[model samples]
Target: MWKNKHITFFITGGIAVYKVVELIRTFQKAGAEIRVAMTKTAMQFVGKSTFQTISKHPVQTDLFDQTTSAAVAHVELADWTDLAIVAPATANIMSKMANGMADDFVSTTLLALSVPVIVVPAMNVHMWNNAATQRNIQTLRNDNIQVMDPDNGPLAEGYSGKGRFPSNDEIFNYIVEQTEDVDNSKLAKLRGKKVLITAGGTREYIDPVRYISNKSSGKMGYALAKVAQENGAVVTLISANVKLPIPAGIDVIQVETVEELAQAVQTQFVSTDVFIMAAAVSDYRPVHFVDHKIKKSADSANLTLELEETTDILKSLKSRRTKQIVVGFAAETNDLLNNAKKKLDSKGADIIVANDVSQSDIGFGSEDNAVTILQHNATNIKVAKANKQIIAKKVLEVIVKRLS
Candidate 1:
């Protein structure tokens, strides 16, 4: 999809730096020119000559080297390209970009560039979780920088959780979107589908002043709704109790409790071609809501609010389904795969997005989602921890494939 585009490719220090050579070649073969910039530490893993030879352009690695900047390097490079992409972004580089630190040439160019930037993070599992590293990543996203998630696989450390970089093709897809000036017709899979998505966490009131809810930011669900609308689907978003700003170009049904969500889902189910239950619905609610918040008294050692099971919205509506695809999510702390499989069958979901939350990499309120899409007798797709927009796009692909 990328043709006649100029891409500013930034290479950072990581074991995955070798992959960038292939990434550069792929873009070149697709009819594009590339400018290469490498971090000081990146040179330790791969030779500067490797990228220079493939790009047929001398690499830029210095911030103050007049020999390179004699051409007004950073400004020229930043202004000449459509977008900049940093592959194998190390924890060190992530921190630099997040905090607006321009100590290095690559990061300095990144801060100066205004078009668009995509950061492909690659680092050790431990480093990915370090408090300092996470803060930086969040900062980058908030700054409107798109980050491609590193796939979970065997790391150079011989350990595996979620710290491997995505394949070259995956990175190329993103580059094409940001840099290339072309549109593909494959985005019309949802042309006539009536899609409904529920987002955020529903609240069950314990009292007039208190309630029970989960930490769902509504980002994933909102993104799903947005993508559906972009693909020509008539989308309806059943939003719950969150302060999230819903995207334009879709209908929104606001709900607060399980009763409201269940009612909304049932009302929309018959006409909906794809039902995405993305809301974190409360499993239980107070048997009786107190009009006033409970008071603390020394004489009362304990206070218990009776609980009642909420409606099984998914299972209850299976008979109401009419050529519609149903999807659900299982956010778990332990026994992830097994629990997800059970929910998939019992809830009658076409696909169950199962995610592990105990590790804290993703789940609940995180912007990134690491999920295993279990479908059709356990055919699974293990998606990495990346931006929710990317995850939503992939999820929609599954729905589209199933529908077709």
Candidate 2:
């Protein structure tokens, strides 16, 4: 949370500019001092008064304004702000910025910033993937400019794609994280570390035709991986039966069974600094798997199949792990603290997420989870049900702090 910050929203020529008004207001209400600068084409989408009303400052758009000295208004605005964020950054504007073509006031002001600059690109999916635009985006990043990937959703181009501007909350979080001190970030305490995480649900084969599985959505694992990446760790994600989108900037290894997951983790555990087993691995599987789907018979009375133990991936990792940080999760129905403490010692994890399973809204496929983070020392802390993203951040911070 930025208690008081300065955020300059540079509105570029794109139809998505309309959404920026609310973003400006969000910043202002968060105790941030905001200023706006719009491109000439942006005015065609939103009026200047709309921004001026929320920012409480004249929307600066002209390179030459009477209120300012002979200096370029664009350069002056860029030099004056604490942070620069360009929203609805058109492909053309992106190309121009990459090439240092500050022809307009908005682009020019952006080129002069000494503080952190965030570029939120919005354009047609095709243009977004164009070689030229991508080169510009990469060039900007190579020059230390932060580019927030566009959201994948409905676009003004009449279809859905990755060109949609990110939500106000997403952009806000990025800015706050970028500006926060290293000690306060998830990375300050975690940089240069290695992490391995398990995600999704494990499948147990009953026969050739059917399998048993849980409702583990893997949202928590993905969130933890993302936060771990932010904390500057080398992250490898081991997944099972996950239908979720692949996370960007992580090494993802897909698996379908507990055996495969155990193999993956064991193969990669030697140098890992942190291991987070958040998956809902299957406990039992058929002792003798059917080669083919069993057919029904008219005289059939009953059927029985012996079940066997699935590999405990976390425990194996713990045995082989000496200096690495091992963390596990316990999805429980009752005796939450008791079960959690058991796992903390049994799994050899440095920490365990002990959660009550009776709350349908906060576990196994829910966006939120209520957990008591139990440590190896039997010390425990109850974290109320909250968004998975927030929980992941908190967990990452705790690990980093303990390590520090």
Candidate 3:
């Protein structure tokens, strides 16, 4: 999406500065011409040579460097840039930029920029929440600079809070939204709508140490959440125990068991305009809960435990739903279309996305997926094998058509 674009990266000193390397590599892989400008403090955390090697361009670090023949280095760079990104934007640098201070190369070049500037703040939790920093951030926002909120997680200070840097995927999606020439109306198709998505596989515990769960890795669900957020929907994600990072700007509820997932969905279902049940919930669970671990018996060769059916969460919400459009997923080994159509009716879902899980390549923990989307009174749309991100856009496109 960044094909042939000239992108300028302004790095400021922070522990999170290390993450900017991956972001730079991603932009470079997307065919962007990247130039990096780093503050003196930023160089303390990451060497200028690292940026030079990755971006394949000379790192800009000084306003008085005689290395280049350009009349004014900062202005020349500012003119060359199509978009400027200030990642790991420290509190100090943010204050400088807010007050129009240009003591360093990063600030000087930013001050001379004509293109839109995106500022991603990274700082200690207390520093981020400080009154002065908040004021400066507000000032930057008021000046039409795009300031993305830092994520909440463990920081370098051995503490956890809302001061961590956002994931590369989150930043990449934001850049795509800003730079892509996609149809504005299509981009905002879900404007003012609420989307609730459930992802990952729910675990049914046999004991404290062991549980039965599917191989769902939550990639599809996360993709849907991202695509929905980019389409202007207020998104809430009910995620199971998956190792994936949460997409920025979405409310996430973590759950382990099917019962917990069901309750979480019920709480959000009323206000949701669109609900996608992408979670791979266990169909049955152990009927008896053993407080202690079961030991091997000397006489018995095998042990038997009763199992009970789990609640059909989607079907249970069928009669209670109002204007909401519900979607369900069917991971079938056979009769994929017929079973998906059956599920479409039985679950009272507006759409049923069916994929053959028997395939070793495309389903269950795979980065790519192919699915047949079945809807009432509409022909099934079969999406070919592709990355989950692409499939997500296709799914949202169909939903937009249905909602229209």
| Best-matching candidate per lDDT | 3
For model 2, the stretches where C-alpha displacement exceeds 4 angstroms are 1-183
List ranges where model 3 is wrong by over 4 Å: 1-182, 185-187
lDDT of 3 by residue, 1-404 (tens): 56556789999898888899999999999988899999888889999999999988899998887444345667667756768999989999889989999887888889987677899989889999999999999999999888999999998999899889999999988877765764323335787799999999999888787777899999999999997886679999999998998898999999999999999999999999899999999999999878777788999989897999999999999888999989899999999999998899888999999999898777799987888999988888987676677578778877887785
Give lDDT for model 1: 0.82
Quote model 1's TM-score: 0.58
What's the TM-score of every candidate structure? 0.58, 0.58, 0.57
Which pairs of residues collide in model 2?
187-231
Instruction: Give the C-alpha miss distance for residue 323 in model 1, angstroms.
Output: 0.8
Clashes of each: 0, 1, 0
How does each model score on lDDT?
A: 0.82, 0.80, 0.87
Please list the Cα RMSD from the true structure of every candidate, rounded to 1 decimal place: 16.9, 17.5, 17.5
**How many residue pairs in model 2 have overlapping backbones?**
1
Clashing pairs in 3: none
Sorted by TM-score, highest first, which candidate order results? 1, 2, 3
Give candidate 1's root-mean-square deviation (CA, Å): 16.9
